[model samples]
Target: MAELMEQSLLAMREGAQATRDTGAACDRIGSAFDDMRSAAERLVDTAAEISTFVAAIDALAQQTNLLALNATIEAARAGEAGRGFSVVATEVKALSTQTRKVTDDIRQHISGLQAHVTALVETANGVGARLDDSRNATERANRHIQDVEGAVERNTASMDMIAGLIAGQKDATVKLEEGIASTLTHVSASEIFANEVVGAVSATDSVVKAQFASLEAFEIKNYVLHRAKSDHTLWKKRLAGMMAGLEGLRVDELVDHHSCRLGKWYDHVADPVLRNHPDFRALVKPHEEVHVRGREAAKRYADGDLVAARAAFEAMNVASTEVLMRLDRLIAAFQ
Candidate 1:
């Protein structure tokens, strides 16, 4: 009978070990869920940043519409002398309207993607909760097994008395078997839960990959300083266009130091070493001067001060040159 009890106790120990292993598996699954949730959150942030870019594009479109309206008014004042200008204004207005509509569509799509990613995060949280519950149940089963082992050990220590307490020993063995059976059931349940969570994580990973693929185009940072230089060149052309009355320019279209692409990058750059570069620090003041003078140029032309407008445009050109030179230095340093 003692020998039989020893075998039963051994089986119960194995069952307990299995339960502990399952609990460890639950912990691992919970950790994976946490990682998934964190990744989903990062994707959501990326979508939000992209949405901000779309908003900037929309703002530019609205500014274009306003400029077109002003052109329309100026053309009206010019009467028959403005007939060609009026046609151009109508076309620009139509184009701006179409651009606004397209941006609106893009915003809706991004919002939908954000909603989906948020749902993915919530689902990951749910899986983590389930894993916690599984771990708790497994722990309870392990405790039960430990109790059964203690009872068997006590029975074994009093083996000489077992003949007189045969019935009691048999009863204890039956209880030990029942405890191990219960523990095995708990282990099986935990295993099932872990499998379910694995499937969920696999599905979430595919979704995250697909979402990342969709957003790959927005990571447009290659040759960013070069682009900034080009933006300044374009601004110069626009200023000349305003002076010749070849284009309608708004003072607000000369966005401030913080609103341009380079400004956005400068504000968000995570590398302290790059951000603290002397050339990087020097780019800001001249950049702001360019915008301030560009807007002044536009305002002067609007106020019919052609000479002051030309002077501001010249000053803006000088500031833009400084900005470009600093950008070149920074770019070369990086290269």
Candidate 2:
């Protein structure tokens, strides 16, 4: 009876040890399943993030296509003036098409990955949940795994936005380069036109100077006689008539004013002749009497003689016309 009791106790101990070992194995398997479930969940989350990113990329590609189409239409409408812009617009369209293709490929790949991840997560969940019921330690580890998966998903989204911004910036740079090239071409053409204008203006100036230099030299004796008739004799007659028209004519008053007016006429004649024909200097007197006999005539006009003023005005007009005619003839000989 003692031996039988001892054998029964040994059997019981062996059975308890087997159950403990089996429980430990189940615990390890649960832990492994939890790890696999977490990995599969993370993979699924990654695929979902990639799908969202790909969708966004597709949307952007659609927008780019619309923009490229608009640019192409605008360029075409501009005709020959926008030939350079048309080329750029064509390039933009090609790039947009290529981007659409890439986005489609990405979307297809992400969809496949998401399907695979979903299957894996389902399998892992089944195994982990069964193991967790068998052992409580696996539940704690599963929670920690889920936290890591969430962090990875958020980071992926941020990276997608950055990539889109970079692509947009590249397109802008291409347009800028095309605009600068067009501006340079326009500036080059303008410079050529400006040079042509300068050449034309220089030729015109040369022609004008040549024409001015064709003046003939006048004889000193003829030039002096012409000045004496126009400035002295003709001007004296005009002054005398003006004096007679005035009511309160005085000889002294006429001499003072008439002398200065006559002097101005002499000076006008002398200046041009002296400068152009220095040989005529011998004909000009240093102290000539410009007033002549007009003092008494001018005095009559100064004394409020209206008839003398009218006669003087008429005489001055006639003499001025004769002088101008002589100048015209001399200028015509030069031409």
Candidate 3:
């Protein structure tokens, strides 16, 4: 049992370390996305400036057209006196028409290019948003792993204490066995000897009770934490689906969907058992803060305040992973 427990502990430690590494990688990825988003925004701005230049060219084409018309009129009044000038005016008018057509074509192409750049900017924003959320989730997982490690450390200390008590019990049992053998051989067991055996048995009971109580606590911890892990996974899957459904849902619908998800998790999975655990109880205020902020983010989104939503989501996401990982590790220990 000891060897098995040690192996399990080692595996868990390795897993936690791996998860921490993954979180750091996720943060790096998020940073890269942020850089990309900034680049995309700059591209959009440059494209907008190009669009302005196109507008200026369009205006210049109009002015040239007006000038060509005036020249044609002046040449017409000159008649035979300005025959060459009339020919030149005609050429100018044709050139003006061609210039206008070319400018119109340029305008169309620039408009298309602007649309594509705008779309690229929006795409970058969405990807950055998702990456930010992923980073937040990973960070939360890392924190929960830390909490688990702390709890495991405590448990380890408790196990060491229990080991000491067991060692004492083993010594007492050996002495008792020798005493029994001596008593049988002598055909006389003293009251003092009987009292010593009784004392040892009582000590055994006391140690068992202490260790048993701790082990029993694991039962409840195991159940709740296991349920929490499952629920966490479900919550993530549901959130992913809701995000994918963004195209079909309006702001209100999106908020409602997310709110309902949180509510169900709170009511059935989190609130029911989590609110009661001392560790989870301590986690409550922080978890509640995350939910409150997330709700605010949803409200901000509904109000057409994307910047506020993104900021709020970032805050909430960090808190969420911390809470989640704590719960995850608690359950993991029991398993």
Q: Considering every candidate listed, which one attains the maximal lDDT?
A: 1
lDDT string for model 2 (1-335, tens) is: 33444454455555555556666888788788888888888888888888888888888888888988888888889999888888888888898889889988888888888888888888888887777676554344344444544444444455556667877899898999999999999999988886576567546655644543342153443443344343444344345434433133345544432245334444566456433653233223311322322443354456666566555455544544554454445444444
- Superposed Cα deviation of residue 233, candidate 2 (Å): 99
**Strongest candidate by TM-score:** 3
Q: What number of backbone clashes does candidate 2 have, counting pairs of residues 3 or more apart or in separate chains?
A: 19
Candidate with more favorable, higher lDDT: 1 or 3? 1
> Residue 302's C-alpha lDDT in candidate 2?
61
Q: What digit string (tens of lDDT, one per residue) describes model 3 on residues 202-246? A: 466457446545655564645444444544444433333333333
Query: Candidate 3's error at 257, in angstroms?
Result: 79
How many angstroms is residue 85 displaced in model 3 relative to the true structure, after the best TM-score fit? 1.9
Worst 10 residues of 1 by lDDT: 201-210
For residues 202-230, write the lDDT of model 1, one tens digit per residue.
46645754664565567644367776676
Write down the worst ten-residue block by lDDT for model 3: 240-249
In candidate 3, which residue pairs clash?
140-321, 140-322, 144-325, 144-326
Q: Residue 318 CA error for candidate 2 (Å)?
A: 99
Count clashes in each candidate, considering only residues at least 3 apart in sequence or on different chains: 0, 19, 4
Off by over 4 Å in 3: 160-335
Name the weakest run of 10 consecutive residues (lDDT summed) in model 2: 281-290
